[model samples]
Target: MKKRLLSRLLLTSLSPFLFINTASAAEQAMIVFDASGSMWARVDGREKIVVAKDALKQVVRQWNPETQLGLMAYGHRR
Candidate 1:
C-alpha cells in the first residue's frame, strides 16, 4: 500500500512536466500517391486508383485535422 501511494505521488508530480513538452508539438505526415497508368488498371473490376482514393478518404476521415498533412501524386502526365 505504501509503495503504491508513493508511486502514485511520483506520477502525479511528473505528469505536468510530461504534458508541457507535447503541447507545442504538432504531428506531421506526408502521403504520396501513385497516379501512374498502372493505377488506372482494373483489379476485380475496380480501378486501383479508385481503390486508393477511397482508402485515403477513409483514413482522412478518422485522422485528427490538427495534424499537419501533405499530399503528392505522381505520374499524372508523361
Candidate 2:
C-alpha cells in the first residue's frame, strides 16, 4: 500500500510537467480590408464592399470565441 501511495504522489507531482507541452495558447487573427473607392463599385448587383463585409462577418462568427480578431482598413486617401 505504501508503494502505491508513493507512486500516486510522484505521478501527481510530475503530471503537470509531463503534460505541459500539450497546452496551447489561444491564436489571434487579423483581417485587413480595402476601403478604396473601387470597393464601392457594383459587382453582380451587389457592391464589392457589401460582399466583403458579409464574408468577414460570417468568418468572425465561425471562429472560436477564445480567438482574438483585429480589423484594419487601408487604401483610403491620406
Report the number of the highest-TM-score candidate.
1
lDDT of each: 0.62, 0.60
Q: Candidate 1 local accuracy as lDDT?
A: 0.62
lDDT of 1 by residue, 1-78 (tens): 643444354445433432222344786666676789998887656676776676566556866787776677889984
How well is each residue in 1-78 modelled by candidate 2, as lDDT tens digits? 643444354445433432222234856656666689998987656676776666556566766776666677888876
Span of ten consecutive residues with least summed lDDT in model 2: 14-23
Considering every candidate listed, which one attains the maximal lDDT?
A: 1
Q: Model 2: runs farther than 4 Å from truth?
A: 1-24
TM-score of each: 0.65, 0.62
